[model samples]
Target: MSAIALTRRRGRRHSIRRPRTGFLLVLPAALVAVGLFVVPLVLAARMSVSDWPLLGEPSFTGLENYRAIAGNDLVGQALGFTAKYAAVILVVLLAVALGLAMLVRRPRRGVGLLRTAFFLPAAVGLTSAALLFYELYFAGLSPVDDALTGLGLIDRPIDWLGQPGTAFLSVVIMMTWRFAGFYMLILLAGLQSIPDDVYEAARLDGANRWQTLRHVTLPLLRPSLALCTILIITGALLAFEQFYVLTNGGPDNSTVTLVIVIVREAFSFLDLGSAAAISMVVLGGLIVLNVVQLLALRRER
Candidate 1:
């Protein structure tokens, strides 16, 4: 081989080592994903097609569970409730998180303390927060009701989780309180990534706060907003602990969510096949939603 041919051959050989090194570096994570996620997913798929009882032998049930799911009134009702709850929670979460992001985006005296206070809720575990709120809203004996009554905010003790409307609102409120801060942090990072010079240019153009926000900040924040919205929607769809603990899907199963329904099927009623089928449906819906959202973001980019 000529000198140039020999050098190019050596370069090709050296280039091949990089990918080998990368694969070695990623092998552990790939193995972990296969073991933790892919394996369980495959097992769940198998269970979904089988009549796997809590105890006893399993038998193939094929699409029976899925067909039953299609005709199940309880599942329909729970799905509808879940959609409405998710919509309300998504709006509230995005609004609060964005408002917070804007509030603390600029540095002022005591801003650090304000940021800490706003972001503190995200640090609390969801289940723990639900339990804490459960105590505060424990019907007639709740201190919240007592305080509200003492302040004449109500004529008597109000049941925060007794009625359907109140139950839904209670869950939404708790979710907003728990997660708004986390989304705020996400939006804040996006806000900080924007060059200050862009804002200065907007100001120089005599743009007011609302106009600047509408034209500049929102356009720049679209990616972060999209991510936050996707996360909020997914989390809302998978809601369980708050409704499970606070209301127990009570007062006529008004607050039952999709995940709660799945849990009830699998554990409460010992219908593993139905639970697995419903889980697969949820997973499919989530995958479609995420794909659509990601595609839309890509188009915008």
Candidate 2:
């Protein structure tokens, strides 16, 4: 080949090589996602369609596991309970966190210490927190019941885990305690991100405190709101530890969640097929809900 033709070919190869290098650099994370998350989900789907036990050989049953769970009353009830639990915890935790953030966003005396105190529970492991609450809500030594009775809120100690209605509320209280402070930090970050000039202008316009919060504070904190909403929703949807430690799906199964049912199928009953089926359902539900949420938020943007 001619020397000029050789040089042109070399330039072309270099151009191709540089772009391919960038693509190669980006490929690792893509490969990780497909290998770790996507592959397991695909395998779970196949497992859900088969009659597999924990110890036995699998046989393709063609939707039998799905049909079994569909007809299972306990599992259906668990799904409803999980939804209710998520709703209650989401509302309570986010409301309390936002309130706390608004109150403490401005530094006061010992404000840093105070924030740390509020957030201390989040540092504790979730299982430990739940177990602590479990002990407290039991009988005789429970500070929660004692406080309630001391405050004239109740005449006697309430068996929080023994009763269905109270069991659900107890779990909500624990979850709110564990998560509120973490969310408070997130919201305070959002609050602080808003320019002081915005509040200054609002004050100059003779706006009251509520008016400033409604118009200025919340509008600028939309991203934070979206973030907290996603965290609370997803966490609540997969709740297992609190109920597992506190109620164990007791009090006539009122506190049973979908995850608890999945655990029971896989471990207690050795029904891997049904467990995988429920897991797939859960994975799909989360994807669909998050997609819808993202679309709605994008529109607002």
| TM-score of candidate 2 relative to the true fold | 0.86
Per-residue error at 100 for model 2, in Å?
1.2
lDDT of 1 by residue, 1-301 (tens): 7999878877885555577788999999999999999999998998899998877888998998899998989899999998998889888988999999999999999999988998898899989999888876774356766788899899887777889888888788888888888999999999999999999999999999999999999999988998988888898899899899889888799988999999999998998888999999999999998999889989988
Of candidate 2, the 10-residue stretch with the lowest lDDT total is 136-145
lDDT of 2 by residue, 244-290 (tens): 99999998888889999999999999999999998888989999999
Model 1: how far residue 182 lies from native, Å: 0.8
* Model 1 segments more than 4 A misplaced: 1-29, 139-153
Itemize residue pairs with steric clashes in candidate 1: none
Give the clashing residue pairs of candidate 2, or none.
none
**lDDT of model number 2:** 0.89
